[model samples]
Target chain A: MGKQGNYSFTGHIRPRQIRAGALRLRATFCLGGFSFLAFIVLTITGVLLLFYYQPGDRAFASLSEINSVLPYGGFLRSLHFWAGQLMVISVFLHMVRVVWSRAYRPLRELNWITGVVLFGLTVILDYSGYLLRGGQESGAAATVGQALFTSLPGGKALATVFFGQPSPLNGSTLNMFVWHVFILAGAVGFLQMFHFWRIRRGGGVRPL
Target chain B: MDLIESERPQVPVEVEQSGSQEKLPLIELQVREYIGTFLWLGLLFALTAGLKVPLDSSPKAAAISISKAPWVFGAIQWLLQRWPAWLSGWVLPLLSMSVLLTLPWWGRKVGKTWAWIIFLILSLVWVGLTFVYWSESIN
Candidate 1:
C-alpha cells in the first residue's frame, strides 16, 4: 500500500510516505518548495522595495536610490525578479504534469479548472507587481498597456490607460501595487479553497 | 455468408478499466509523471519570494509578451487577441464541449489511442505556437 503514485500530505500522514528519504522529497519539493520560497522572498523584498519606491515621477529616483544608496537593494531587486520568473515556470510545469497523469479525470475536474483560474490570477497579479515600479520600463509598459486596454469597449475605465492622456503614472503607482496585493490577493485565496475542497472530495490526490 | 468470423472488439486500444476488469482498488498515481504541472507552477509561486524575473533595466515593450499567463488559457487568449471575445468565448466553449461529448463515443468505435493521438497532436501544435509565436505582453 506504500505506493509513490497517489500522494497526499494532508491529514495524518503515514510514516511510509516520508520514508522515501530526502532525495525524493527534495526532488519532489523543488517545484512546490520554490513556490513557497518565492512567496516569502516577495513579501520581504516587496516591503524593502516599497521603502525607497514612492509612486509618481519620483519613482525613477527611488529606483536610483535602491540601486545606489539602499543597502543590498540591487540584490533584493534581483531576488524579486528571479523569484517571480521562477514561480511562473514552476506553475506551468506543475499543471502539465497534473494533466498527463489524468489526475483531472472524473471527479477532479473542478480542481483542475480552479487551478487554471488560480494560475491565470497569479500571472495577472505578478504582472502588476512589476508594472507598479513606475520606472522607465514600468512607465513605458503601462503606456502601451493602456493603449491595448483602451482598445477594449470600456478600457478607459481601467484608469491604467490613456491615449496621449495623463497616464496614471503621473499620479501614484502604489495603486497598481494595491490592486495586485488586495484585489488579486482575495481571488488567489479563493482558489486555494477550491483546491483543498477538490482534494478532500477526491479523497487525497490518489487515482480513482 | 461465412465471409467474416469476427469475434473481437472493434476498438482494441480503448481500454475500459472499470467494473470487473478494473485495474484493482487503491490505485496509485505518481506526481513525478506530472513534472510540467508542478515545476512551472512551483516556480511561479517561488518567484513571489523576491525571485527576480531578470529583465534589463531598459524595460522593452516587447518583453511584455514573453511574460505569459498559463498554457491552459493560452489558446483562449490567442483566439481572443485575434478575434472577438464573444466569438472566442461562445464558439470555443461549444467546440470543446462537442469534442468532449464525442470523445467517448468515438473512442469506443474507433480505438481510444487514436482519439488520444488526435487530442495530443492538437495540444502539441497549440502549445508549440504558444511558446514560439507568443506575443511579448508582460501582463
Candidate 2:
C-alpha cells in the first residue's frame, strides 16, 4: 500500500485519496475547517500580543500601549480579537451543520460530544479573554462570573481559584492570564487534535 | 471458492465504500484547503484594517455602569437580569447544555427529524436572547 493507504500520521491528517463526493464543497461546507483556521490565526496573533501584554495592574496600560505605541500592534491585537469572535461563531455553526446532516448518530456520537465540549470551552475562553482586557467592563464581567461561581456550594474557593482577586475597576489578574494563555487554550488545542483524529478514524468525512 | 472468500477479512462498510467510490488525490483537498485559508485570511485582514476594535475606557476612570457582557455571554446575562442567579446562571444554561450533549441519544429516542427540531428550537431561543440583549445594551 502507498502512503495514502497507510495509517501514517500524514495520512491521518489528509488521506492519500478521498471519495470524490466528499470533495464537493457541500460535503462538510468546510465549517470545521474554518473553525480550525480561526484557531490558527488566533494562536499566531495571540503569541504576538503576548510580547507586550501585561497582566494584573499593568494589564490595561500594556494593552493601551499595544493599541497605540507598538508598530502594527493594534492590527495584531484586532486580528486576535476578531479571530476569537469568529472561532466562537464558526464552532456554533459547525454544530448546527452536524445536526442538520444527522452526523451525530451512532458511530459519530463520541465526536459530537467532543465538539460540544469544545464549544463550551471556546465560550469560556472568550469570557476569560474579556476579563484579561483589564478594563472596568472586564471588571464588571468578572464580577458576574465570580457571582455565578460563588452561588454554588464551596463556590467562594472555586471563584478565587479561577478568578483570583479582581477589583471592580480591573479584572486582569495573574490567575486569569495563566488560565487564558496556558490552561484553557492548551486544552482546546489538545482537544482539537483529538477531534480531527476521531474524524479521520471514522472513515473521513461522509459523502453528502 | 465461497468458503475461502468468506474466510477473508471483511472491510467495514464505510471503509469499503471509501475504497470503491471514485477517488481523488489528496492534493485536491489540499488545494481547496489552501484556497479557503487564503480567503479566510483575506477577510480577517480586511476586517482588521477597516474596523478598529475599540479599547475600553481606562480602569482608573470612575466606574461607569456596564449593562453589557461580552456578546458571547449576552444571553446568559440577559437571563441573569430577569431570574435568580442559580436559575439563570446555573440551571437553565446547564439544562440547555444537557439537552445539547444528549442530542445523539435524543435522535435515537425521538427520531432524527424531531431531534433536529429540538436542536433548532434550543438554538433559536439562545440566539434570540442574545439579540434581545444586544438591542437593550445599545439602547
Candidate 3:
C-alpha cells in the first residue's frame, strides 16, 4: 500500500528475498493464513458488535435487544462468535502442524515458544469474549474464574488487575467488557505481529 | 611451483541468461494471498449468516449448579472436579505451558519426542474428561 520503491511490508514476498517463497504458500492446509483471515473477520465483526452492546447491568438486556431489534445484529454477533471459534481452532491446528513438521528446531525455538504464548493468549481472548455476553452462563463463568484467580499467589491483587474487584453483578460485567474488547484484544494483536515478524526472521515456516 | 600453469582462464557468462531468474513480483504474491483470504471470509460470512447468536436466559438465584466453564476449559474443569482448583486450574496449567515454552531446548530429537508425549497426554486427558462430562450431563 506504500510507495513501490519503499516496499515495506510487501518486501517479504519478493523472489530475490532469501528468506521466504511460494512453496510456503503451496504446502500444507494454509492454516496460518486461515487463522489470520479468521482474526480479521473477528475484528471487523467485533467492532460492529461494539456499537450495539452495552456493558454492566443492562448488558444482557442490551444483547437481547441487539439480537431481536437491531438490523443484522444477530448475524454480526454470530459472525464474531464463529470467527473467534475458528481462530482458536485454526491457531491450534497450525501449532500442531508446525510441531509435526519438525519446523521448530534450532534457530526457530524462540518462535515456537512465542507461538505457545500466543496460543494461551488466544484462549484467554475467547474466554473473555464469553464474559462479554453477560448471560447467566457468563456470570457463572466469572464467578468460577474469580475463584480460580483468587486461589493463586497475590491472587487477590492480580485478580483485581485482571477482572477488577467484585461489585454489583453489572459492575463486574463492565470490567469484563473493558478487558475483553480493549485490553486482551490489544495484547493479542501486538503479540501476533511479533509472532509473524519472528516467523519471517526465522526463515518463513520451513521449506515445503 | 608452476602457479602460472595452475591459473586457468575464467569463462564469462552471458548477462541476459544470468538476468533471466524466475522471480515473481511481490504484488503477484499479495494478490494470491488476498484471494485466499477473501474466499475464506466469504465462506465464513455465509456460515455465520445462517446461524443466530445464542443468548441464555437471565441469571437466577439458583444458577450455580448449571454454570459450566466454556468448552475450551472442559478438560481443565474436569481436573478441578477431581482435585483442588489451585492444583488443577492454576498449577497444572502453568506447569504445562512452562514446559511447552522450554521444550525446544531439549534438542530436535528429544524435544520432538517430549512434545508428542505431552500433546498425546493432554489430548487423551481432554477426550476422557469430555466423555465423563458428557455422560454426567446426560444422566
Estimate, for each residue in A1-208, the C-alpha lDDT of model 2 and write its tens digit. 5654445545566667766766778768888999988988888889999899999999999999999999999889999999998899999999999999888986778889999999999999999999999999999999999999999999999999999999877889999999999999999999998888777666654321
In order, the Cα lDDT scores of the candidates are: 0.51, 0.87, 0.69
Better by DockQ, candidate 2 or 1: 2
* Model number with the top TM-score: 2
lDDT of 3 by residue, A1-208 (tens): 4486336333432333322333355444677778877887888888887887887677778888888899977887888888888888888888777777656676677778878888888888888887777666776677778889888777877777777643323223667778888888888788777777666544353221
Give one digit per residue, the lDDT tens place, for model 1 in A130-188.
56555444554455456556666777786543222324333226566566656675676
Interface RMSD of 1: 13.1
Report the alpha-carbon TM-score of model 1 versus the true structure: 0.56
The CAPRI classification for model 2 reads as acceptable
Tens digit per residue, CA lDDT, model 2, B38-97 = 887898889888989998778999879875589999999999999999999999999999
- Using DockQ, rank the candidates from best to worst: 2, 3, 1
RMSD to truth, every model: 11.3, 4.6, 8.1
In the order shown, the chain A TM-scores of the predictions are 0.72, 0.94, 0.85
Residue pairs in collision within model 2: none
- Worst 10-residue lDDT window for candidate 2 chain A reads A3-12
